[model samples]
Target: MYKKSKIALAIGLSVGLATTAGAAETNWRMATPWSGGPWLERDAQMFADHVNDLSGGEIEIEIFPGGTLGSALKVTNSVKSGVADISHNYINYDYGTDPTTALLAGHSSGLTPEEFMMWMYQGGGVELYEEYRRDMFDVVAFPCAILGTEIFLHSNKRVETLEDFQGLRLRTSGAWSELASRLGASTVVMSGGDIYSALERGVIDAAEWGSPEMNRPTGFQEVAQYVIVPGVHQSGGFLECQVNEEVWTGLSEDEQDNLRLAGKLSVFESWLASSYDDLDAYEELVSGENEIVHLDQDFIDTIYEETAKWEDEYAEDNEWFARVLESQRDFKETMSAWPEYRLPIGTMGR
Candidate 1:
C-alpha cells in the first residue's frame, strides 16, 4: 500500500534533483520528544526520508530529537504557529487542549494500530479529524504513527494490590496519570531523562514507561529492581505527526499519500522493534542478574479492574471522549460476532 506506484520514477527524479546544482533546496524541520534510540524518533526520520525520495529532493526534511526545539508539551502550538513544519508528540500530552484527544489516543482500548487506521482512513476517523482540527485550529494533523502498548510497571517495591500503590511515588505520564490519581499514588509526569534521578533520589518508588526496548536505554535495570508485564493502561495507542495546514494542502497527492503510507510502516515497525527489544531486554535483565518479578494473574487483574474504573470516571466527565469510545465499542460489537474480526490481528501475531 505504498503511496508511490513505483520506486524507479522516484529514484529517477531524485537523481535528476541531485544533478540540479543551482536548484534552490527546500528543507523543513521535523521534531520529536524521543531521542534517537526509540522507533518513535526513527519513524520521524523515516518520514523525512520518504518525503525526500517521493518529492525527488525538491523538499528536504531535517529531524530534531528530544524536543530540541522546545518541550514536547508545546509541539502542537509549535506546529500551528509554524515554529516547526513537522513535529511528533502523543495526544496524551495535550489532552487538556481537548479531552476528546484522549479518545484519539486510545484510552478506551478501542482500535489496535492497524484496525484504527481502517477507522481513520476508510472509516470516518479521517473525516472527523479534518473537521475537528480545521474547526478548532488552523493547523492540519492526522493519525500518523499508532504506537503499540507501552511497558508495564517496573519498580523497587512490589505492586501486589491497590494498597501497595498508596503513598508510593511512581513515575507515569498522560492517561496513566488518570489511573494513578485514582489509585492514590502521587504520580509524576517527567521527561524520560528524569526517571533515573527521580528513582535515585527516592522521589519515586515505581515507574511504568514505554516498551522494554524503549526503556532499556534509560538503564532501568540499574535503577528499579522489578519488571512487570502486560500493561493494561495502554493496549494499543495512537501517536500523531502534525503538519502546518498550509504545508499539508500544498503537497501533491502523491506526497500526501506517501506520508500516510510511511506513517503506517513506522508505527507497525515501531511495534515490531519494541517486541524484539523487550525480548532482548528481558533476557539481559535475567542474565545480568536484575531482579525480575512476574505479577500473579490476580495482581494484574486487580490493576485492570481499577484502571477500568478510572477510565469510566474519565469518560463521564468528557462527552466527546464518550462518543468516540461508543463508536469503537459498536464496531467491536460486530467484531465479536465476526470470527475473522479481531482487535489488531496483525499486531497480536495471529
Candidate 2:
C-alpha cells in the first residue's frame, strides 16, 4: 500500500509539471490582409516562424490569411480590438484613420527601398511610427517587411503618354487615388481581391496592385494587356506587424526583443527575396502576351513636380503630416550627396 501511494504521488507531480510548461508558452493569432500565395503572405509566415524560433518555442503565432479573421482593410483594427493578437499589414491601409499614415507606407515618387530603410532604422522613423500608432490606435507596430517598387498600372487600354491618363478609370487606393484624380484619371477604390474582376468586366480600365512578383500570382497578365512600369506612386514601402497593446505589455523583455529582432530579420529577408523574384517575374511577363510599357522621362518628371506640390499643400493642413513629411525631406536632402560621392558616372557597371 505504501509503494502504490508513492507511485501515485509521482504521477501527480508529472502532470503538474506538464501543465506549468504549457502555461509558459504564449500563443498568438496573427492576421494578414494578403492572400496565401504572395510574397506578402510569405513574409508574415516567415516573421511568425522566426518569432517562434527566436523565442525558443515560448511564442507561437498562427497566421490567418486575408478575410479569415476580418476584412483585409480592417486587420489592423482586428489587432487593436483583440480579435487578433497581431497583424501583418500595409501601413496605408489605415489611411482613412489618418492621412499621415500613408506617408509611412510610401508616396508618389517617395523614398526608394534602401533610403526608406535608412530612414526607418537610422532616421527615427520607427520611433515616430510607434508613437503615432500608440496614440491613434492603441496598438504597437514594427516594420516587418519591405517591398520593392510596385507596377504602376496593369491596363486593358494603352497608356503611352501623359495625355493617356485623361478620363481613364483607374483602381487604386490611399493617396495614389487622389494623385490619380489630379492627373485626370477617375479613381476607383476596391480591395486587392476585386481588382482583377473589375478590370475584366470593364468596371475599371486600369489598376496598380503590387510589384511584378507579387502581381504574377494574381494572374493579371491574363486580363490586362498593358503592364506599365516605374511604379512612381509607391517606389517602395514597409509592411508592418501590429501587436495588441495589452498583449505586448504582458511579454517579458526577452520575448519583446525576440519579436522586434524577428521583424528586422524578416525585413532584410523580404527585400532580397522580393527583389530577386521581381526580376524573374518581369522576365516572364515580357516573354508572355502582355505588352510592357515604360513611362516617358517627361511623364515621370511631371509626376515628381505634382507630388511635391500635393505634399506641401497636404502638410499645411495636418500637424503629423507636416512633421513626418519634413523628416523624409530632411533625410532625402542629407542623402542627396550619395550619387555624387558614392556612385560612378552613369550609375552603371562597377
lDDT by residue (1-350, candidate 2, tens digit) is 00112322353244323333454777899888877665445688778767765655566788888888888888888998899999898889889888888889888856888889999999989889888888888999989999789999999988867899889999999988988888889999988788889989999999998899889988888899999988998998999999999999987665666677778878887887888889899999999989999988888888888888889998999989898999999999999898786865335773
Model 1 sits at a Cα RMSD from the real structure of: 4.8
Which stretches in model 2 have alpha-carbon errors above 4 Å? 1-23, 344-350
Candidate 1 residue lDDT tens string, 1-350: 12332443455365534443344677888766766675445556655565566556666777787667677667777778777888776767776677667667766353455566666665677667646666665666666565665556768887665677688788887766876777688888787777888887778898877766667788876877777656656656767777887788876565666566555555555555555666786677678756666556775566667755665676798666666666666666755665565454436755
Native-referenced Cα lDDT, model 2: 0.83
Kindly provide the TM-score of model 2 when superposed on the true structure, using C-alpha atoms.
0.90
Question: What TM-score number comes out for model 1?
Answer: 0.81
Name the lDDT value of residue 200 in candidate 1. 73
TM-score of each: 0.81, 0.90
Q: Whole-model Cα lDDT per candidate?
A: 0.66, 0.83
The whole-model C-alpha lDDT of candidate 1 against the native structure comes to: 0.66
